[model samples]
Target chain A: MSANWRLNVAVLYPELLNLYGDRGNARALERRCQARGIDAEITPVVIGDHWSPDDTDIILVGGGQDREQRRVQSDLHRRGAALRDYIEDDGVVLAVCGGFQLFGQHYRGWDGEIMEGIAIFDAVAAHPGPSIQRCVGNVVAIWEGETVVGFENHGGRTYLNEGQQAFASVVSGFGNNGGDGLEGARRRNAFGTYLHGAVLPKNPRLADRLIALALQRRYGSDAPALSPLDDRAALRAHAEALRAAFSPAESAIGRRFA
Target chain B: MRSLGSGGTALPGLVVERLHDGAAGALAGQLSATALITGTNGKTTSAAMLARILRADDRAVIHNRSGSNLMRGVTASLVEAASLLGTLPRRTTAVFEADEAALSAIAAAAPPSVAVFTNLMRDQLDRYGEIETIARRWTEALGGFPGDATLALNIDDPLIASLESQWSGSSVRYGIEDPDVPPAPEGEIMDAVWDPETQDEFRYTRRYFAQLGRWHTDAGARRPVPQVAADQIDNAEQGVSFTLRFPAGERTLSLPAEGLYSVYNALAAAAAATALGVPPDTICSALESHQAAFGRQEDLLVNQRRVRVLLGKNPSGLNQALRTLQAPGERHHLLILLNDGVADGVDVSWIWDVDWESQAPHCRSVVVGGDRAADMALRLEYAGFPAPRAEVTRDTGEALSRALSGVPEHEQLVILPTYTAMLEVRQRFGRMGASRLWDVA
Candidate 1:
């Protein structure tokens, strides 16, 4: 990237899709980029707002409640074409929990109402019924040899299509669905996960990887090599989260998922 | 009940319920009157305030003072207060705080003559599902109450005020009417901002922390005028003083509890008391003399240093506690505890939503403790607290000692803990010769 290269981060439907401190992921990306001398601009794209994918380097969509998801469904559909084109061009996108479900093919809510997704990842999420317990508690997963830890609370059971890649293998806690050991979905530069300890603040590697990918997409072969900063606190938090996931009490709770 | 041993808050009630199918309803029916307090936050303190008001009015009040707010806890309190023949004394009044999720069941069992609804915020999604689900449950619960039962609702909270539409009973609407109070910062988690009917974003004319404010939408939805409103709120390090306005008259109440949230609790309790026909002087005096519920801004003295325990279970509550810490002029010594136990909502992600960035720099020394202590420390680190200044000690007792020792002689140490962590701290204090958890008023 050029010396004065700047990254524009578009946070989609922040008023509607913000929950469980998921905006921390956007903060993590911006802070980490700024620490490396990259000027990262975060713009919140609410219901009445629009953003051009050509000008935005990274896009973040957080989780929300069922009502909020319903409110944002139409707005997301309106912007679905541009988001799909951005993903196809290797643009970096991180969608979490409810946002993850909305980025898939479609989500069937508890009342059986279907909400169309952007289909960036060929997946479908369905709520079995209100009678079924939500998939909740600490989660530990392995993503490309790195152990990622977070908390997952969702009623929707997501299933990736045949050609879609699983984001990570769940080591503990329910992920995606209790029936499957896999968690999240990844296609090209687009990633989606049910994890929300704001996920990226603890898992710095995943955050930096997204930043690096955004830089590469913005500047191609001339992209500057990403600089590494001290991640002691983040790594310590990551270790603690992993320990919490495997603790005796949490593990017993995890057995309920079985 | 005390003879049953440690952690017996809910067990005795469970046994009584199993013995008699309608034990709760039967016991509550024996009382002269009963008031039920339910909300996401401020249940314990509000109930305590109302109970004190009733006591000041020369009425015998039985309350679940230990903050065991579940259905079983309500039953336990009733059983403990009943005579050997399973009957309550003459003119005995009951004030019980019900868990937000268990309100319907508790209300049905107790059959309250008055109900108090505090503001609702995003809390324990892993346990409560979503804010809307709980709101729906509360609306259905209100339908089951007798038409004569009065509701003391916080009108500032759009969600709680909206509950009035489903109930036919008279309501005493209370809210903060102080326009000078700081507006809610951008990006704060507003759990109830959208108009459910119109799906239009409600515009706030005056916003406070979280979603408590005077709001209106272009489509004509608006907050109702509160009959009991608070204005000229003066928040100090010692306590909060506010002018409590009601239908009869207005009085200035100075509560020993810290934070504007405590003022809300006082307003809620005052509204309930007013509905129950308590005199304004009695309510004001009772509230002013009201002691903080255990771990809800309760204080302790260890050695020569003062230790204040502030309970912070969710994002909004924690933010308010942090704001309270900022009120004191001097830099503070902090012991922050984050637990993931069942009561603490296993998901620790809510910490990130707290406005720690604004408060971290004001602390002189920081020690994090609990099952998820490292997570709290990391949060402080990200919030720009110097790495070397934050010490992580997972044990609550050890962390308290370290934090207290860090404070200079006669200085105050502030401890912010989640539900289970607060219990752990209280247990340690109990062992150190402080009053036992149940012995406190």
Candidate 2:
């Protein structure tokens, strides 16, 4: 990595975020870096904001309630070009819940507002309502071999484009449990998920993956190791505790709708 | 871990599921009198106030005193309060703080004799999608009520006032007539106008902040303005107060809460109590004696500093928080705690609509905290305010300490946090304990 490396984390439309505490995402990212002895300078970038895409390393976005999502579409459209440029250069991006939908092709907000997304990851988020699936469980990704436990509350049914596939499969509860079953997208250093409980704190490995991806792009394949030493035992214990507090006996595998 | 079956198994926190599945909807249509106090804002405070009013009348009232209005929360409250046979005790009345969407289900279950619409604002957009949709749902729930049921409506709120036509039952509308309560800020966005003349089938006279300023129109029949028991809603350092107007007479109430909207809330609740056939004295006494519910303009003392809670969920509520901060110039310290969740939907459009760019006092150095802390900070920056003296840390207690310490002992620290963040602030400054409301003093 460069001697003067500063991770630029741009958060989108934080004013409209609701549901689980979304402010946790930015803090979690900051904390992850701090824990690794890395000084991460975070900047808040909003719509109509003019900034150099190269300055940003990690782009973090959060979830919000649906109506707020619709209201923000026009503002987000203003940042369409910059966001596309940031993604094109393999800039690491992280979006959660509503943020995920906002980054994708489009988020069909309630009342059929066709919110034009930045299309960082070719995905269409469909609106689901009347009853939303509140997902809470341990999600073990088969490929990444990393277990992530968090909550997901979205009324959107997402599907990936023809060539795209999900970053991870659900070991439990409707990870892209639609007919298309796209789970979450991780393509070309762009990561998005419906995991809303400050995904980094719950799954530090995922944060490490994003950081590693950013570092690798900046400093070639032989980049300095940036992963925080994993306390798997502690993580496992915490996961078990959360499962105990949230959902137990439900295995890390199921189509259960929390 | 056990199934929700097999002879009433008690899982450590899944009480709501147990009640819903195990009781076979036993709570449905089971109460003698069910009253629901619902709105985006003021539901908890109004419900608590109404509960106090009912309790004053010597009637046993059951409610989620802890502000646990979610499905699990409601069922858990019921389980704790109900008899072993799952039946309410004699002379019982239930005053439920039903969630905006959950209102329909709760109404269907409890079949309330009276439903109060406090007001509607844009909140949890990701969840509810739109204000109109929520308004429609509320109308549906109110319409579902029995013909004889009484609907205590807030006529000042165009959304709530519009529901008058939907209710086939007895309706008593409450609103404020005082023209002095500050006009809706100018430069409001087009969408924020809340135009009553929309081409949409569902339309009403538009007013600012979901508050249309007390109604006097009609639905097929001209209805006189329902007497409001609140006037001269005060929000200065002298403390909040207003007169309670009733058909019998008017008694000025010394309100223990801050904010003009709160006075309107008291007016609405008092009017509702009167509509419910409660005595004027009971309504007047309860309102006079009422204290602020947790985070609903409640005051706290930590290290000899008084911290006031001003929880804002949307542009309307945030505007209220900003507008009500009439304390000009440097002396008063305002601490704002905003998170992504506080915004409640992914939309940041309301940021422009709030007019905080100009409305927020020049001397006020906002302490922004939450998932959207930087967003809030940036907005303030965009609005020409220098960076807040400090961006609050994730630790809400530390943030509170920072804000509280910065303020002089005599001056109050007005805290404006979102729903969950309010709970965090309440837990810190006032020791309200946890989510359970029984222990809060």
Candidate 3:
């Protein structure tokens, strides 16, 4: 990338969808870029704020409570077209948990309330009610030969459309619908997942991948190859998370869900 | 029993709960009055404070002092307090700090005459689901209480204050009314920021921390005036002093605890004490001399160096602890223990929500420890602390030694540990002849 190339990231509804330390994902993105000598700027897009897709290279949306989801539902719908346009232009988007659910076609709550989504990803999430166990625990997934580890805690069982692709296949812990052995949905450069150990600080590879994608979209052929930093802490955390995901004691919750 | 990995604090209660479902209720019924304290944060400190005030009033109190606040823990404490004939003293009062998620079941079993609701914040989402859900459960549970039962509520929290309208019992509402307190910083994790019914963002007139504040919405909703309020909160290195106003009278109390959050705990306790007819002098004196609960600002001397153990289980609690550290403005040596144990919520994601960045510059040195030490180190590294400055040691005991060794002779070492990690620290201290394990009541 050009020496002056900078990445602009827009965080959507941070006031409403900032649950589970999801904002950590944005921080991870910013820090990783700065570590590689790239300038990254994050702008929060809250209610009543106007954001331009032309100035945004990446977008992040985190999870939230059900009421917060409802509170942001209408506002997200208003920004849906612009977000869809940005995605079509190959912009990088990482939507986690509630954000992931809202990136799909629609989400049907257990109480029979349906919240419309932007339809950028061909997926739908449904809550099976409080009677059914929530899909929660340490999760290890395989994404394009990379091992991604995180913590998944959500009550919604998401299913992708017939021709859509999953972001990763679950190695352990319940993901997506829990029965599908799949976690998250992916379309083009847009990604959605329930993994929220901030999902990026531990999975530096995934974070770097997202950053590289955003850089490529902004700088095209002149996009610079990213440099590597000391990831010892990240690697150790990843290993620990992976071990916890496979440990019988920690996996007991997964067993109960099964 | 230790080989089974159980602390033995809640095991007997679990056995009792399994054997006879109504045994806990029976034991609780024997007490003259029972008070159940529940919230996302401050339960232990608040309960301890209230227990002290009750004791100052010469009332015999049975309490779950082990920081195990589950129904099983409550049952266990009651069981231990009962005589072999399965009876408590005629004038005995029970004070139990209950886990927020388990409050419904515990309240159903114990039927407390006084229920204390501390402020609700985002806590242990992996275990408690959400703040709204817990608030809903608490409201529904309080509905099941007797009409004559009294409630001690925090009016600063819109969610907690809203609960009073749905209950039939009288309430003593408590809050901090100090306008001098600074507004909460941007990017701090906040719960109850928006009205669920109106969808309008709640505007804060004065915010202490998280969602504890005097607030109003555009739709005409406003925070209820607290019957018991504190003002002019002075957070000193030794403790916090505040002017407390209540129905009976007002007094300046110098509580032996740190942080504005501790002041909230004191207010909640005083409110509960007021509900129980404890005199103002007795409450102030008890609070001034109150010893903190174990791992909640519990201090000790280890290897000739002063050490303070602060338990931080969630984002809000951790934020408050970090805020306390920043208040002194002097460089601090910190040992932060991050565990993903079941008791610590299994998910360490909440660490990201804590405003560690604000305290990063204030840390002279930091040692990260616990099962998730690497994660905590990574968080600190991202918070602008030099990566090389933070030493990651997975073993809590080894980390404590390293941290203590680095502290100068006159300086103090502060340890911030999660729930299970705090227990581990206490055990290490206990082995080192620094302090006893679970000795605070």
Task: Tell me, by DockQ, which candidate is best.
Answer: 3
Name the runs in model 2 displaced over 4 angstroms. A1-258, B1-16, B19-30, B83-89, B189-211, B214-224, B227-235, B247-249, B341-352, B362-364, B430-441
Once fitted onto the true fold, the runs of candidate 3 whose alpha carbons sit more than 4 angstroms away are A255-258, B1-7, B388-394, B436-441
- Report the Cα lDDT for residue A194, model 3: 93
Residue A155, candidate 1: C-alpha displacement in angstroms? 0.6
Least accurate stretch of 10 residues (summed lDDT) in model 1 chain A? Answer: A249-258
Q: Which of candidates 1 and 3 is the stronger one according to DockQ?
A: 3
How does the DockQ of candidate 1 come out? 0.81
List clash counts for every candidate, in order.
2, 21, 2
lDDT of each: 0.86, 0.64, 0.85
**Candidate that beats the other on DockQ, 1 or 2, i.e. the better one:** 1
Q: Chain B, TM-score, each prediction? A: 0.95, 0.84, 0.95
Question: By TM-score, is 2 or 3 better?
Answer: 3
What does candidate 2's lDDT look like per residue over B68-94, in tens digits?
A: 675555566556667778787777778
Local accuracy of candidate 3 as per-residue lDDT tens digits, A119-224: 9989999999989988888898999998999999899999999989999998888889888888899988999999999899999999999999999988889898
lDDT per residue (tens digit) for residues B41-74 in model 1 = 8998999999999999999899985668998899
